[model samples]
Target: MVKLDGISSFVAIAEAGSISAAARRLHLSKSVVSERLAELEQHLGAPLFHRTTRKLSLTEDGSAFLERANRIVWEVQDAVAEVAERRGSLSGPMRLSAPVTFGRMHLGPALYPFLARHPGISLTLELDDRRIDAAAEGYDAVIRHGTVEDSRLVALPLAPSRRLLVAAPDYLARHGRPDSLAALRQHRAIYYTNRNVADWRFADVRQDVFVRPPAALRVNNGDMMRDAALAGLGLALLPSFIVGEELRAGKLVRLDIGHEAAQELIYVAHPEGRRASHKLRTLVSTLREHFGTPPYWDVV
Candidate 1:
């Protein structure tokens, strides 16, 4: 295989206009640069330069090869930068995907400080409610909720996904709040369409219980669901982070159910072997730090 060193030397010599000039720029002896050029030319079976004391210029084959050589050199430099970023100092673009609701409510606040701290990194945040293939979709990392089924991904837990059954005070007054799990059947439901089929799960002492509430209105986004609850449409099970502000403002009321709500897991997933990248590691750490144990949003 033709070595990258030779290709890089060829590119430098072509750009610098002579092996001697390239040697000066590279801090190498002219002889070494000439030898590298000769080796590359030998490997390709072509004379890359029209050499004379007066001037140096590229031949036809050399012109075509120079383009590829330049690209190769650039690729080599980029690879070095990528490795360097993973080792310590951070730079380059970081592509991240996340669920719309959690990202806006939680990750959005945390990201500002992280970006401020690392000015070298350019971040792209893509928000989608549907689960995407992290590797196939070309994301550096993704924020996901509940059980991470993709064994190909490495996960870092960000927070506990605690959902609250809530409704507007007007709805509760008009419809009457259910005091227990069984009473939920009597309530009209505003469903988050993205939720699991056996959606409502709760804790009853050491065991678990599941309920599928009948849906009066179904929507894909959490913010819309929160709006529905605030509009007094019906009772909805919403993640704490999305409804924290509404709950705190007394626009929505959390029912004191007889059993504990089952907790789900929130994770940041990356393609396997990607956890070591400084960009991914730093982002995950920042999110973990922001969320903490019970998470600030869940305190209410």
Candidate 2:
């Protein structure tokens, strides 16, 4: 019979991408983890990973093994959680990924009360603007803005947010407000370099669209874009969630360009067709409840 312990160790190593890291996480010695992995390979009669001095990469067989291993591990964990819940408690670590500013400003605040409500649940939240592969990264779920592109993932719409073109009061006073998209060419623009730095998509309708003019100051960080706009560096296109207070306080003015700069649809997404974990489902449902009546950005 395949030993569940050895299989669990192998899965840990595969997910961690390094034996040492897996060992650290599992609180097991590196040698023990390595030995179990070797035993697992022997039982399967195939190499699962490409071991190197720096990193371990899954072989094709390992990748296939990982998919099943993830399910098995979750299933075992679910059984434990089921028993725990019967005792009226939910307990586990949840890994979540989200965009930097939005997570910090909007989602983080909403999650605080939820976390407080569930003392048994621990969270590892990674804040980043870069698109992440949740499955590869082993995230329980990701809080995302913008339309879903990958059909492989299951997406639940958590909220509606919009991207708006705006300029600081000072900037608009100096450079003058852009009357149309064509006038954007005459103004200096602060850009999020990591995002669509050169070409910004805007539309009057779903079918009618065009790209905006290029930017002069290209930055990678969304917060930096907000800072630059606040400092009167240039006009910026930002999600309303990040600049809602600024706009409300009259620090920034929404540009009346008479077009929607594409919608930013917020979603809680995870791997498709996977059995929903109790903790993950609870968290997602909580968010859906918080965002059900359209986010504060819409009203503000």
lDDT of each residue in 1-300, candidate 2, tens digit only: 668888889878876778888897677999999999999899999999998788889999998987788778878988977887888887888889998888888888789999998899888899988888876666778888877887878988888878888888888888888988778778887777655433366765432344455565787677888888999988888888888889889998889777778766898898776666788888888887876667766765
2-27: candidate 1 lDDT, tens digit per residue: 88889878877876777787787566
**What is the overall TM-score of model 1 with all chains considered together?**
0.70
| Alpha-carbon local distance difference test for all models | 0.81, 0.81
**C-alpha TM-score for every candidate:** 0.70, 0.88
RMSD (Å) per prediction? 12.8, 2.6
lDDT of 2 at 190: 79
The segments of candidate 1 whose C-alpha lies over 4 angstroms from its true place after superposition are: 1-88, 204-211, 273-275
Q: Which is the leading candidate under TM-score?
A: 2
Flag clash pairs in model 1: none
lDDT accuracy of residue 120 in candidate 1: 81
Worst 10 residues of 1 by lDDT: 204-213
